[model samples]
Target: MAGEPAVTPVPTDDELVVVPLRHWWRWVGGAVILVLLGLLGWALADAKIDYAAVPGFFTHDIMLRGLVNTVVLAVVAQAGAIVLGVVIALMRRSANPVARWFAAGYVWLFRGLPVLLQILLWFNLALVFEDISFFGIWEEKTNVLVTAFVAALLGLGLNESAYMAEIVRAGLNSVDHGQVEAAKAIGMTPATALRRVVLPQAMRVIIPPTGNNFINMLKGTSMASVIGFLELIHAANNIASRNLQIMETLLAAAAWYMVVVSVASVGQHYLERYYGKGVAR
Candidate 1:
């Protein structure tokens, strides 16, 4: 045989390589199997379940109010979180050491403590000082319900803000240094540069995490019930207590939560895709 270079193997056009099993039937078969398994499990679970009990408990007015309360709490708390998060992020990145330390310490303290404990502490603020007046303005006595709502909002919002602050800071930091230099070279003020050039780019990073936090905040609103805010879970608790079908009422509550979360998830996905387009091109 003559001396010759060894030939390297190459695949023909008809040959499959990556994901070799590209048959459409495979995916359809797998999907069908999964559906069959799910149906079987549901049928088995339903046989022992009391569907009638679930319906009776789900029809209560308090349960309806609880759902509304959950929505309110989530909206309020997330609004507070966004505002505080932005402020804390700005403070963290400030040139002043005092501002930076204050922001860091605030985040450190809240992030370190349990959310439940914070809620409880706020709930008991009246016990700490039953009649404390702020700036001698309105000296009206605080009602338990109002106090509890405020407490829950404060606890949830402030704690959530710390995490959001970190997310925002990271996003801002991710912006290209060259952009900042360009802004400065163009005689833009530091604040103007940050507002115009940096924050807009950072929004691509920030929005997804912020939306996720909002969704989580919706679930976290359930924690407000612990402080007597009568959110969705609390309403479910009351309904279950009256109906003697705690499990069923709880399931109804869970179902509602699933619906709410699902809607939020869809919205988040769309927003994420929208923001992602900025980076893709």
Candidate 2:
């Protein structure tokens, strides 16, 4: 008895094993999806659609340039929107009444306006703030020209900021209040507590929605074409007009958009997963 080691007893079959119940709808759904996919593939490969024209889609200079411009617009606008959103979110959350009011007003004003009207407004904004003068002594023309590119950037970025502000504020608020208290207990300043404690924890909740916004912004960039900002859709329109292959050109643009969105989705998946780790911690 002194030399013997203790051993735990194993559970019986009823205690150890658990079985799932069968669901008939899952099988039906799988079969339906497979049948639909088969039909789709067959229809696409049929001679009615000219899949051959796809290769020529990128050969034209207009489409290429439009794609480049779209990429540049999306990247620049999203970056600017994200930075502005963070500042606005912080202001919205600030204890200072003035900061809170200004932030709230900004979000309300921008979010209330339609994006198209906003684009047109910024495009024609030069009519109002055309001149800059500190006093009556000296004056210079303001540099906010509503060029096609500038109009699209300002419209998209500013509009995006309002939405991003809400997203960021939601994320910030989702962080545990106790963490802030703990940070303060350790003598961390408000700014330091936010940066070191709140924001990092908040990112997990922030990333997924932010990714959805980015994807929407990518699509929104196409709206820039209305103001003569030659992004992918506009490029396709130009090429379609010139070549008379309207369907093909538009289809090509659609394909490209899908591809870009798909890639963004993949990136978002990884980002959510990465931040998911932090949330777990």
Question: What's the TM-score of each model vs. the native?
Answer: 0.83, 0.84
User: Which residues of candidate 2, in runs, are more than 4 Å off?
Assistant: 1-24, 42-48, 127-144
Residue 179's lDDT in candidate 1? 98
lDDT per residue for candidate 2 within 66-92, as digits (tens), equals 888988899899999999999999999
Compose the digit string of candidate 1's lDDT tens values, residues 27-102.
9999999999999999868775677776666667887788888888888998888889989999999999999999
For residue 50, give model 1's deviation from the true position in Å: 1.9
Counting clashing residue pairs in each candidate, in order, gives 0, 0
Superposed by TM-score, candidate 2 places the C-alpha of residue 150 at a distance from the truth, in angstroms, of: 0.9
Clashing pairs in 1: none
Give candidate 2's error at residue 144 in angstroms.
Answer: 7.4
Model 2 residue 89 CA deviation in Å: 1.0
In terms of TM-score, the best-performing candidate is 2
